[model samples]
Target: MSRPQHFGWFLARGFGPQGWGYPSLDWDYDWTRPEIYQEAARTLEQAGFDLVIIEDAPSLGSADTIDLRVRHAFGGPKHDPLLLAPYLFQATRHLGVVPTVNPAAYLPYTAARQFSTLQHLSGHRLGLNVVTDTGSARHFSDSAQLGHDAAYDRAEEWLTGIRSLWRSWEEGTLVRDPDTGVFADGSKLQPVRHRGAHFAFDGPLNAIPFTDGEPAIVSPGGSGRGLGFAGAHSDVQLALAPLDEASVRAYRAKIQDAAIAAGRSPADIKILFAIQPVITSSAEEADRIVAASAHPDDAALVQIARKQSSDLETDLTSLDLDRPLDITIFGDHVSRGSIQRLIGDRGEDVPLRAHLTALARTGRITDRSGFVGTAEELADLIEELGDWGNDGVLLWGDFHPVTLHRTLDELVPVLRRRGILRREYDEGGLQANLRAF
Candidate 1:
């Protein structure tokens, strides 16, 4: 029998607007209330999804101005996902609620205590998606930003300290006997004295040992240092790799090798591909949606350019859209991988305006990519990828209630019938459920 595939949803806008421009007459459209998230979590739970990850960033994009970012809602005005976690957990029983936490933004002690407390309250269903903040460091009151590799180094130290703090109080540390005067076992508790290059902490964590161990550690980055970090530290690694089977397999192999080098079992680390599936009832309808979704008009083009410029820290507005772009101008400001993907097969001499326009028109600039087809066709694609050594998929949709409802009510049932998806969650916490497959 085929191994059961894990399924997760990538909440790009944590408790915020989804399906930015798309019509959502069915949605309540009130983002401030937790009802939308609660409803979404319930839907995923009913569908037997493994987890729901809330993606977050500390700063708005590196754009020259916040106007575009706010106006377009590309990366502006997001409430903390951590705040939403408790509400989500209360609303669902089995589905894991993983919130993104930037190591750079939070102190080790604070993160340890917060996550540990949640883990205890949620029956160990909480998860932490550790992110190395890459947005403008100035936003965090830093005079200068660390280089790419150095940031990961800092994250490594941060995670090490966090883990140390979590282990401060061992199991059985608490001995609450009403008859006896002593309420706890002092000998069992240990203080964490960790001094690292990036961070230092001295003392035991405030929280007690978690019932199911530490909250699941999730790492998301595709760079060399990122893969290494994920292999060594994370239980799950979210990847946004190319959709081709060979490329995906190769990336998985790289991560597996890193895990082996790090003295970890390959199976201990699960790599989930990030995908956005466009599902429709019929092939013709699917084609129409895909075609419409691919092409964005003038407003979308501006929004895309503005978002990219903010992220790359380069102002695309100043550059003439009709003229070719000088890649040299970006210098170290932008990620090389991002630039390469944007340029694609086109030479550097290609006009910046044309590039952004093409991205806007094609709707390919965003991180979301996957098949546009009927539910069964989409399931086939997911299964084929899983058969090629992928652990699971982290799905992103248009965020319309109808779209999400269809994915859960329509697509998931089909997968379950084919034995591609789980019929019910394994009895345990988030970590156990993750390791079940």
Candidate 2:
């Protein structure tokens, strides 16, 4: 893998409690602080990151949530991601800003217009992470939250309509035909009338066509419905699993297969894994920071695991953390077993105790391992993952944006020196960045 490969910055106000792969912050940090986000964005731009993926969650499920609950108590100074787009766009010249949006919450026409406007404002630097509401029904009106497959079905139509509206006008469609005294070419614009199972659209969008086409589509989901959509349209496919070689390989293979099945080249979609790095001048210092950091409570760990586990009913929190993890605990959730297989494939032949500790040390080590080291050491580890089975990495931020900030300042340059990271922004827009792969 060379400098042209994908390396994106991941954000979630990591500085607070529940930092990446660890517990949240002590006192909840003020996420709305402009200086906070600005510093983070500046770091990534300096480091030559391909994009900044800012995630959005509607709400925490509930109070008294178990440990590892992604729903936090009081996330700070939050604002709509769309409103923040220009802030990040203005902060960096080339870093793509990908913000997730749910089609269910807003009309497709409105979203199309917003993103098209964003495309013009950002100079085509925006990317879209299309989501079809994997959340609970309570988040929407009684009529909105449809079944899973139905949601995707509706999404397909929504995307189709959005695309049509984007091409509604061609470049130079607005002609200064002063001879005819015409302000625009009317024939070049067309309305998209779509009537699908879940949605119906019949009007032309309010904004002009974005010549670059809709921002590069990214899908974080990989379930049957998700893979089908992503394989057909997504430029980047986000995967979350333990950071182990086998896990990385298996996930990538599945996504490729999905892409191939969708009648698109498997290489069209890049697989991105979340990785949080702790960097220092020396590898030992990085190791010390990781070692010194406290793991979130056992309950939190189990709850986090439960979210991805197919067998959500099984409560792993009650089990003794000291006890050797019984594979039987994953009974019925074949996916959980698949996760365990990844750890076992690592070629370690230690006793059950050591294996258990290895599993516990990483908190349900499905396959991925965190890299804690100096910049050079971290870059080497990234190279190792690239060799193993990673297209690129999504650097997870802990403590607001501090983890990402440090990475851009310290680690990225090391990778660049080794010819593993880009020295300058790739020419063109967000879609161009993803298409370069």
Candidate 3:
């Protein structure tokens, strides 16, 4: 009613680790050191974080690829996100655990059962992040990644099947009737014999459906097809928008429009932007931390920019920071298609190198749109974000555990005191907490 709490919580792995920072080999982490996942879960639990996102990627990209190698420590080794979930859930009573899973890699029947089992175990503190493949289906030697629109079609079918499995046995369907030695009432159990172009599954899942029901779906698809798929099925559409105000507003408009076109409530979809908060007792100290943590390598900077804007291919050394960027050098590899389209529309003729450097500088230093200040100042920045139509921030870690802790300990309380954030968590899973909001 009072603008239903706008922001929600989400965290990822590798954000804040005591063991490693940029330029260090990612695998070099002292595994013996306290794991970031555990620490972050505890931190979020104490801070009333609504959800933690467990990223799903089969293997790290090779160090040669610009996008993956730099930010991820030149192709870092990893742990299974799902494997970390139970501990995370157990460690934190109220936080939701959203694990990213590529449906193409695993069968729906198997995934449905696994999610259902987890929901039962975690007391419905589970959620799914459905990501269709990026481009190629090389991840699957058996089957190719579904085509653009087709992938969503498959996702819709896949979601339907999963829900069917969850709802197969209604309440009181399994009656312990001893009079005639009949153990159950079989009428409510419906076999979900779902068969489609991309997937096929028969009957109910192996596991008993959770008394709390199936996990809600969160989709991060901003691609046209992906957005449509999310609008049709997802409980929360996790969106990543640029730092610029115009960019953020435009993306919000587009996603909400897509949601409306799909006959879904635009309010049901929440927009989340990546934030790297560097907080200190004073604004100047926060700035110093940001400056100290800057990624010195220009190549790495260019690579990071390339991830969001795929078109820029200029060497960072050649850029003049004070000028607008030119577009012709991008040639064919247009990045994050939507952002590129925006740039193309603007028709600014600055050098490509300058453009990349500017983007790199922004991303490297102020992940939170330069929200470095005292707790009160940081709260002001978050409230500003809210005023602009965004629901919340998805914080990215700058150096390691310190960055995450600083925000939670210093800034989160400020927001809570302002009547913007929850003072105490509602008792339940991620979906329950969100629905309450």
Candidate 4:
């Protein structure tokens, strides 16, 4: 038997091209329009998913690398996810739309008012996936570029300010007396004056309060500082870890410990691991796909190189394939951890082609190991996570109808049969759905 768990989808490509360069493009869905994502949101809501988190990185690569960023469509060319959230909300009643928002891009007071308005509009189903990427600071006039930990600090301060604004309306502030035609009691509204190292704002946000519950907070950071911020403030922690039991336990323990250290209950935070499982029709097909990736041809290698170039903001496509990359190729701005992950078990002496080749290969989901598998096999991995006391898994993919159906069509039945996925949503909304199990 398996315990029921919360599930979500991560719009891995943000609001960018939904099916560009992929076979899904043949479906001819206009990625620029809202219909593609609205349909996807309905599919997820009908499938009993609690939320869909839209990932965003506000900047194109640095000035010198804009071509690398948009050429392959690996990054950039994204519209604002916050603006897209309302369409998603209008599409589904229970599905939470959590768009990635950076403190650097939005002012505290404006964000507070906008988010609160959406919360009420969505019946408390709106959520913000707070990120602290400083790469986009250059785009905003008032934004200051900060180091990693400092960026987290600013985000913490920024959230603290927004929440303060959300709580500005007192318990008895709304006294709608039809007889007197009085809508609100002005004296009951509290003045919110906040002055923090990163932000200063005054708000008794004009937006009405959320009746179900305030929009649930979501965070996606794996560093210690990131964990601390999430533990202290986030309702859902977008986690990443090895799928095995012990690693799952350890990663969960870190989140639990962080919450406890912050005087917060571990139960208050739901840790949903991020996974991109390639669902195959059968185990043999999974094996065949995995084997075919081992010796990636020139096209495959270049594709990987283009993606890496976008991520590192340094061109890798023109590099000599036979030679090891220069250690200095990455700039001071690129994340060390990201570079290390891309390097992946390679010494400095390893050839650039060898590194990209390794990335092209993937693994199976057998023995609770990897993410490539059949739908039934993927269900087993999810059930095992539930057994390990995991909250759930967030399926990472583009928000396209074809992509959504491809992943969920076969897998949803398997999960539903095993009692791993919910058949229907509970009353209130997304918050209610998250708290249902």
Candidate 5:
């Protein structure tokens, strides 16, 4: 028997427009209002998902890149996901709402107070996907402008300050005596002052302390510094790697090593691999999708190019199909990982068309490496992960009801019947839900 695995949804499109490029936007739900997301949140809870992670990129880059970011709605024009969390909390009782939050965007003092209030408000289901993005530092006048690893340095300091603020009130400090009408012991409030290399703050936050644990911390970085930060502080590591049994076990060991170095047990952090599987109704449909990808025409290649253009911060639509791509076209800030991911195994010497064509080629799920598959096939991969002692998966998609149901409608029942998906949410909210397994 396979042990159950935790599951979450990654709202890759953020709190902005949902299904902008897809035909499902015609579903006619207003993305601006809260109703669409609320409906999605309720659907996720019913499906036994533990959480939904909202992805956000707070900047549109320089004047040259604004069109690339917003023209296709790939990166920018997103509202604050932190603000959207409350509406999600209102819609569901158990699903954890982890909104992307940048240390560069929010002051430590302010973030702590706001996060603390939300944690208590939601009964501790609130979580912060702490990001160390330095591109948007200009938006906040006081924000530090740091380099790659330095950003992690500041985030470490920032997280330290936030936790200091969270623990301002001593344990047993809040004593509610109805007879005396005393809600808290003023004497138990500890002095909270943080003076660090990146941040300085004084706190004894006005927000009440949580009776359960504090809001969970999540990190999505894959670098050495990123892994260290996750090991030291995060309750959830939004991990990414190949999903093979060997790769999964190796990745788990790396995280365990990092945790051990941080004086924490390997189990202190849950490793939820980020997966985006293409689910199909049957083996025939899955094969059809893969077959269509083998030789994508100009129109299909252009569609893939359009999506890549938005992410790379450079347009690929105009590039000559038969000629090699000029590496110079990408800006300094574009993630090399994203560009490499686009090109995949195809070398840089190859023509732009070859790279795009390789991307368009889809493989069968029976390969255990590619994503296209039926619900039963997807479950097989998931069960294999559990058998390897892997934690779970975080499914990536738009936070819209249509996209969600289309993916989960067939998948959830199969997982539940296999005894993999959670049957009921554990008590004490998100943190408890995570540790429950």
Candidate 6:
């Protein structure tokens, strides 16, 4: 029998209301209100989703100037994901709330304490999505931005320190007794003293062990080093890959290999691929929605280029649109995965302008992987991928409430009927629920 697959939602805005853009006015309630997020959380819980991940970027935009970013609200004026977790937890019983956090921006001690507190309060339904700030180093601190691998190196150190802190207070240390007037067994508490490459921390955590265990750790990245970090540390790995069985299978194998090399069980880490599904009653309506979401003209194409420029940290506007791109010029500034997707097998001779225009037209450059069809068709696609060894998928839409509702109302039922998705969450916290699969 095929085991049921796990499901999670990727909240692109991190509890913010900017995802649907001005069109959100159609259903606009106060974006600042916590009720909106709570409602979404309740819906997910009802649908039997394992978790909801809040994606965040402290710095937004990659253009030569901040004008475009400001005009579009591309990456600014966002609310903290951490603040929304409590609201979500209060509104739901089983759904895990995972917030994106940059270790570079927060000290290990602070991160450990904050997550530990949330884990306790939420009944161990908390998860931390560890991400590194790649835009600019100055945004994080006065120090220079580290290179890709170096950033992961710092993250590894950060995680090590955080884990030490979490383990500082061992189980059975809290003995709250009135007869002897004893509270904690100090002898059982040990100090975590560490002097590492990127951080130095000493002593035990101030918080008590509140959950069944430490809060679950989630890691998102596609690079080799990123995979290694996830294999070694994360209970869940959020992967981005082309929507094909072969590609996904290869990626899964790579991750499992990394886990084996790290002296960890391959089954311990779950890999969830990011998917954007556009489901409507018919294929035509879904196609129409996809078409409407794309860039309509040359000016819009330029806008896409500008966004890519911001991501690549280079001025793409100056390059001739007709000329082939030289990938080496961008060096390590741009994400390797982005570069691979942009250039593909066409080689460096692919025209910069024409390529960007094509990407804008198809919405591939901006939206990436998407499936346009009815809910049944989507379920078929998902089932096929799962059969190819994918553990699960991270579902996302255009950040419209309608889209999310349709997914819950239409798509999830189809998946459930196929016996591929869980009918109900297992009896446990997030970690136990995740590991149950």
RMSD of each: 3.2, 5.8, 5.2, 1.8, 1.9, 3.2
Residue-wise lDDT of candidate 2 within 1-437, one digit each (tens)?
A: 34445888766542233343343344345456445566667777777778877766553432323332443322322356767778888877888888877777667778788888899888788888777654434566666446667777777777777887787776777776889998787777776687776667776666776656468777776467777788777888877766667767877888888778878888788888777665666645655555544455545455444443322233444555555555554423123334443346544333333333344453111112455666666677677777775778888764255455556667766687777777766566777777665
- Mind giving the per-residue lDDT tens digits that candidate 3 earns over 289-314? 55654543656655545443321223
Instruction: Tell me the tens digit of each residue's lDDT in model 4 across 55-86.
Output: 99899968777988898789879999999999
lDDT of 1 by residue, 286-379 (tens): 6566578555666666667877765565666677766888888774535665676567667878787567755544222122244667777777
Choose the strongest candidate by lDDT: 4
- TM-scores across all candidates? 0.90, 0.76, 0.78, 0.95, 0.95, 0.91
Q: Which stretches in model 1 have alpha-carbon errors above 4 Å?
A: 177-181, 289-300, 328-337, 345-347, 357-370, 398-400
Quality of model 4 by C-alpha lDDT: 0.87
Stretches of candidate 5 off by over 4 Å are: 142-144, 325-332, 345-347
lDDT of 2: 0.64
Error of 2 at 356 (Å): 11
Per-residue accuracy of model 5 over 229-322 as CA lDDT, tens digit each: 8888888999888788788888888888999999999898999998888999899999999888899999999888877887776778878999
Q: Is candidate 2 or candidate 6 better by TM-score?
A: 6
Off by over 4 Å in 2: 1-3, 14-30, 62-78, 170-172, 176-181, 241-249, 280-360, 363-369, 387-390, 398-401
lDDT of each: 0.77, 0.64, 0.61, 0.87, 0.86, 0.78
Which regions of candidate 4 are displaced past 4 Å?
Answer: 142-144, 322-328, 345-349, 367-369
State residue 324's C-alpha deviation in candidate 5, in Å: 3.8
For model 4 the TM-score comes to 0.95
TM-score of 5: 0.95
